[model samples]
Target chain A: MKFSTEDLIEGIRSGNKRLIAKAITLVESKKAEHRQQAEELLKEIMPFTGKSIRVGVTGVPGAGKSTFIENFGRLAIANGKKVAVLAIDPSSAINKGSILGDKTRMEELAREENAFIRPSPSSGFLGGVANTTFETMMICEAAGYDYILIETVGVGQSEVLVADITDIFLFLKIIGGGDELQGIKRGIMEMVDIIFINKVEESNLQKAKTTKLELKRALDFIPAKEKGWKVPVLLGSALYNEGLSDVYSTIDEFISLKKKTGSFEGVRVQQAEKRFEYWVQEYILSMMKKNNSVEEAYIQHKKNASAMVFNPSTEAKLFVEKFLSKGPD
Target chain B: MKFSTEDLIEGIRSGNKRLIAKAITLVESKKAEHRQQAEELLKEIMPFTGKSIRVGVTGVPGAGKSTFIENFGRLAIANGKKVAVLAIDPSSAINKGSILGDKTRMEELAREENAFIRPSPSSGFLGGVANTTFETMMICEAAGYDYILIETVGVGQSEVLVADITDIFLFLKIIGGGDELQGIKRGIMEMVDIIFINKVEESNLQKAKTTKLELKRALDFIPAKEKGWKVPVLLGSALYNEGLSDVYSTIDEFISLKKKTGSFEGVRVQQAEKRFEYWVQEYILSMMKKNNSVEEAYIQHKKNASAMVFNPSTEAKLFVEKFLSKGPD
Candidate 1:
């Protein structure tokens, strides 16, 4: 309930799992006191945050996301790496509990000594991931985890935001599914760095191969974000643990290549800038709620217009002008 | 360009395509004079709009979006309805032209007497549809079109925005291709009112059917927005015009059902509210750019606190405060 900044920082720095988990819970809490504590914790851990590779994995409800992450995490650990799996389960608004029954679905990998699995319920965010997922990843990284795997619900806009925060975005797919070639929303696919054809075992093996070929053809029509980094379509079987090693190797190659070319740092800087922007937007929204001026004006505007009269633009301009005239923070 | 708002309104009411197009161009233009003219035009034509059914069509690139619209528009015309197709072409930053060659692709539909096709470039808006697309739809509605079809580049955030503005959202797909179910973004699927398994001709017929079944199964798992209104998965050959009537009937059914429940009016009101909000946001952004004090402060904020710069939320709050302090407009 009461944690000094130094205590949290030292606990996280020493890789104290219980303390780290507690800190994450504190950060994720909505209580007023918790927010202040979380902010202090973040500031203290800021210096050690950017060292790890944060990878985001997202797929549809039955897309074998958990199975794939468990396999992938195991593969990374086997390759002598410290991996942390942050599984974001979709939460029910009414109950405020995870829709997915339990985190035990990924028990095998969770039991591994080198792998850490934490399932966080996605509470009230449109994007499949939680608002604090980014901060959680940073905390995980500061605790000396080299690989932070963010597992998203893959059901909403949250995955894209999660992708934005992660170093690599893996979009998982099931082979021979009807949605194939049905033109996945370009927004999500465009953000994807790696496309994994999951459930590539037994009867689906050939279909997975065929799907990969089709995906490759489709990728040609899709413009690449950066040159030389075409989104590779890889085959994997989370159930059988097939091709998991190859996936890990490919990730390593990507990270190393990005580091060699300075893109690793470049991406981090961009992400930091984006985070700053997000914070500002969030802080302003909070400020608006606190001041209630926007709401008041909105009410007045509605009365005068005799229609639905919440004009965000005009109201925004007024808010900015008043805030600026007050001069410096 | 210098015509009076009355002339523009009269011309549009009289079904003058040139005048309607010119009015929309004026609305889209950044010029201050054009904006003033556009405002006047909107005021005059406001009553005439809201009669037309605005439908948004989106799919991945090479999903034959232009061809589908061309076919769909002809179908609407065959039903004795005046159709307006607003096609947003994917713009290349270098060439500044749409990659899909919109005008040429929909040449046949454009030539039809009952149909009007206007190909607009994306112009770098986040949502696949352009900023002016909403206003363009209004302009088209005012011009006496019974059905307005907004065709987005389908691959990005634009599709979602376009869907928000339209009454019904049509998601097109190519059979036996791409990532199938796993590849398509779940958010888009959930938002879609009708999922058309497009290009269902020749060798792909069986595949399309299977895909439809798979989609039907997938739909069962996700929560439906409209109670009892199943998100129909229909197979159609946009190239050969097979099952075109079915698509029209489905749309008609949806509209009739909504009307019966008074949801049609509710939806229109919501759309208008959305448009107002969008315009307000745009207006505020413009005002922020024009205001010297806010501009200076924004710059100083960026410079002084590079890492913690004010985001849109903060800026919006400030803008609102400023507008309120300055007294009523």
Candidate 2:
């Protein structure tokens, strides 16, 4: 964390794990000085970023997500590829529980010299986990981690947010009879590019196949995520390490298909454009929360709102106008 | 449309149909002069608004929603109650094809002197259908329409928006064997206050009963919307005009229960508060879109973003600062 910006950039480029972690910590910092430093650090290594394949893995709590990611990460390392895993921890925000770092769960991958696993950045700056995770990913990419796996808690808005930054979104579903019934809930089926039916080893093989068929039928009602690619449902056993090659192959197929259709770059371009909007909105909201004058105005505004003497648009405009008069500079 | 503000206010208080329609047209207009007038008009009607019991009705395209509303509205009118219908035409903003007015479908209600049915408002600023619908509802309430039925296309984001503004959300389910299966899909089942199994006239009676049982079991997993109320599934035949009094009784009971429990006023106050945030976000986005300098900056920013020369948050802040410098005055 104490390294100069130039040295940090050099360390990351040289694949120094300690420096990579420090750089990620710097980006995750909420302090203004750290942010300024992080910006400088990001600027120095900007060219080295965007070389990795970002994949988002999501499922409900007990859906074998950790086990699957562990095996998948180890498999990639065995193939002589450098891998990095970043998780967007939802517990701290939703339940105020302890951090759910997969360090213990992914024991083998944690020990793999060719792999790196980072816990979800602690809640910082309005608890903006997505932004922190994204910044951490850039640091990982600069550190020469080629395959970046982003794991999000499948509940709430985390999965949708993860899908925006990642290239392919893979949904891991446990082999259950109610697969079709639960898949379409929360509109999750419409967002996924691939479905992995995990825990399909031993006696569960037939049930998994039936679930695949049911899922395919259920998906018929929902539109495809991409134009040319049909979301293939593949069976897997993360515990027994079965049917993962097909998973990577499907991802490769998706990447090439998206590239061929030019949607790969197209989606990324849109994300870049969305980033501009997000920054302005987040900055405006945070500043309002911090400003005493705006806070006072909002209290008065709420009273007027309850009395039906004022409307939201006019009051919001006034709030912004007053904030502007404070002179942001 | 040409009436003075005092005249318009008096006309609406007297339930003058022509003046009420003109006031709604004013609210639906996007021009600056009209918007200024609309705000003033809304202020005058604010005391009279929030008098209606708002209900949102949604289903898939072929779900007999129009037919059900027709018979149900007639039933309400027969019971000496005033009814108003507002259909949110999704085609205008999304599909751009035919208008989905309930005029033809609800012939009986359309002919009733005690009933007032308005088609969806034409596109206005930012193509905000929900805003127009809310404004229109206020105008209708000023004219003393006590029972307000809002019809939304159930497929997309519209239903969720409708749910926020209404008192009770009613989901109409045709007596399909897969009622329970499809209802839980997309988390829509969890949001409804009541589910109506429509078209259970003769041959579909048995199937409807079975569907109701299955739905009740499936709903057991979903938490209740209110502390003391459970979502009841009922069978009805809209075409035959049978079992509709029970529907109104259930609604009346729900209103009395919610009023007694203080949640009726509670939800409305929360909605008023949310309106403030929504207005701020929408106004900010719209103003940025209209500013030519900001537009040019965005184009340049996108280029820099793709080249990794800049990130979204920093560029967005710079863009906002530039916009602020133009002087909002």
Report the C-alpha lDDT of model 2 over B49-91, residue by residue, as the tens digit.
8888999988777677878777888888888878988876544
TM-score of each: 0.64, 0.81
**TM-score of model number 1:** 0.64
For each candidate, give the TM-score of chain B.
0.87, 0.90
- What lDDT tens digits, residue by residue, belong to model 2 across residues A276-297? 6666666666556566777677
TM-score of chain A by itself in each prediction:
0.86, 0.91
Compared with the true structure, all predictions reach lDDT values of 0.68, 0.74
Instruction: Show pairs that collide, candidate 2.
Output: none
Which candidate number has the best lDDT? Answer: 2
